[model samples]
Target: MSEFRKCARTAEAAMRSVFPATPLQLNAHLSARFDADIWLKREDLTPVRSYKLRGAFNAMRKLRVSAPDQTIFVCASAGNHAQGVAYMCKHFDVQGVIFMPVTTPQQKIFKTQVFGGDNVEIRLVGDYFDDTLAAAQTYCSEAGAAFLSPFDDEDVIEGQASVAVEISNQLGSAPDHIILPVGGGGLSAGVRSFFGHSTHYTLVEPEGGMSLAAALETGAPVSLAHVDGFVDGAAVARIGDKTFARLSDMNLSDVLAASEDRICATMLEMLNVEGIVLEPAGALAVDALVDVADQIRGKTVVCVTSGGNFDFERLPEVKERAQRYSGVKKYFILRMPQRPGALRDFLETLGPEDDIARFEYLKKSARNFGSVLIGIETSSPQNFEALFRRIEQAGMTYTDITNDETLGQFVL
Candidate 1:
């Protein structure tokens, strides 16, 4: 075996003492839909509900062996990483200081606290993650604690490689392709290194956080100017330097960007159809299947479902985004005459499958006409075409603001 694979095997062997191997099961739903042998490496089912625990446990185990006196560990994260570190700290009986942004949801903070118990100190630091990270590093330097990076450390990378080790053993052979979700590139780098061209690979990222693609183009990691934080799990602004070094040579075409709205649709499908709850980042690999359907057809493919840390509170937003993306829901501003029958005229134009979701008057005081905001939900996308025709035939003027980001933000 190659040196990297050997180290990965060692890590995998060590992981059994901490937690059982995550399941690798053939997904009949995905197999039938894609016309391929679709296997899911269920990293989402880990103790901390993410592949992150693997790296955290491995890194801390090796660290304690090498430097017995270094009992204090520090890390900064808003979600899965924090929970992973907390769980490992408790398991190892080590003291850890975890820094998280103040804006982190109470649900996440509560879970982290429950995982770490008394072994981890939770610090609610700055408003932003970057600021929280800075605070953690500063505290580490002042207190002489060892700072643990979420993805930049060599030991952590080695730990993540354990995922690949498990996959190979579980599958009994290399698959035709492996699809991985890239955040800071740790998981992708580790898995890619272990396989080393033995199989084809597809790297996926949230469209708003395509750090790997940007790094490949610039020849170095560069911070994105703006990032949509909807996919908070994989919405990294920049790829980690160490992780990027291993993945830098990958073909740019292999990197796929999934849209935030479209990802919501995938999340809903997995929940409604497959009965799986996936966080935004956790769903990346599966969501990417749409883009690679042709390439993976009739081949054995594995998709690593990285995490399942979804908050039930976000379900409404997820549903809304899914409906919007599928064109089953839309918002529009209509110009209506300032008369009693004018409102009834518009109401009479609705098709049988159309339902009004939202209605508000924007210009109630107009002398001749009033502007009304209307949200319509229909059974199918074609329903909108028919609805629009009815509105036009009635001589009512309207602007479809469902896709107008600016207007949607302000009104919808």
Candidate 2:
């Protein structure tokens, strides 16, 4: 076996002493839907509700041995990695100084603090993640402390390979295919290192943040001009340098981009149908299953449900995105005649299955005409066709703003 593979096997063994292997169970619902043997590598069940702890544990353990007198560790993360590192710091009885953006949710900050107890100190450094990272790096340099790169370090990648090791052991061999959600490429690169080309891997990235795809396209890691933060867990602007080197040989056929809206729909489906609550990034692999549904039929496949750290407060937003993606809801601006019976006539145009979700009046364009912003939800997408027809027949000029991202952001 290669040195990396041997080290990964050793890391897997060490992990068993710290925490049990996350379950790899066949998912009946997904299996039935996709006509495949769909297994879930339930990383969501980890102590940090993510596979992040495995890497953190492995890296920290190796460090503890290599430098017996080293007691300080530092990391910068807005979510899962912070919790993972902090938890391991507590386990190793080392001082940890974690840096996070000032805008990080209080819930996350509290969770990290709780996991580390008194072993970790959290510093809210800057408003943006970039600034926070810079602050953390400077602190590490000035204090002469060990800095943990969430996904880019050699030791970290070896640690993350433990996931693949566990999967292989649990299944008795590598499965026919494995699907993983990609962020900075740590997990994908690590899993690839252990499994090699024996098992096919489908790497899914958030459509708004396809850093891996960008790297593969350019033959190197490049910073994205824009990144959507909706899928915060996977919204990396650039693929990690070390990670890219490991993943540069990936097949184009194995790469995919999952939309934020589709991910929300998958999250809702898993929660309502399977009682699985997945954060947006966690649902990426499952959502991409649609793109490969026909190809994987009758094959044994594994989808790494990356994390269950979903904030319930975003439920409404998730529902809205899902509704829009499913075409069951819409937003439009109607030019209503400014008269006594105009409102009544407009209401009469709505279909039976349609219900007004939002209504607001804009400035009157003319003394006889006013603009009305309307949000409508329906039981079926087909209902919109009939509803739009009625509005047109009523001699009303309307603009569909549901898919108009700029107006939707500002007005809706």
Per-residue alpha-carbon lDDT of model 2 for 1-412, expressed as tens digits? 8899899999999888778999999999999999999999999999999999988998899988998888999999999999999999999899999999999999999999999999999999999999999999999889999999999998999999999999989999999999999999999999998999799889999999999999999999999999999999899999999999999999776889999998999999999999998999999989999999988999999999999999999999999999999999899999988988888998999888999999999555558889899999999999999999998999898999999999987987
lDDT of 1 by residue, 1-412 (tens): 8887888899899889989999999999999999999999988899989999888987898889898999999999999999999999999999999999999999999999999999999999999998999999999989999888899888899999999989889999889999999999889999999999899999999999999999999999999999999998899999999999999999999999999999999999999998988999999999999999999999999999999999999999899999999999999999988887998999999999999999998555648988899999999999999999999999899999988998877886
TM-score, per-candidate, Cα-based: 0.99, 0.98
Worst 10 residues of 2 by lDDT: 362-371
Off by more than 4 A, model 1: none
lDDT of candidate 2?
Answer: 0.93
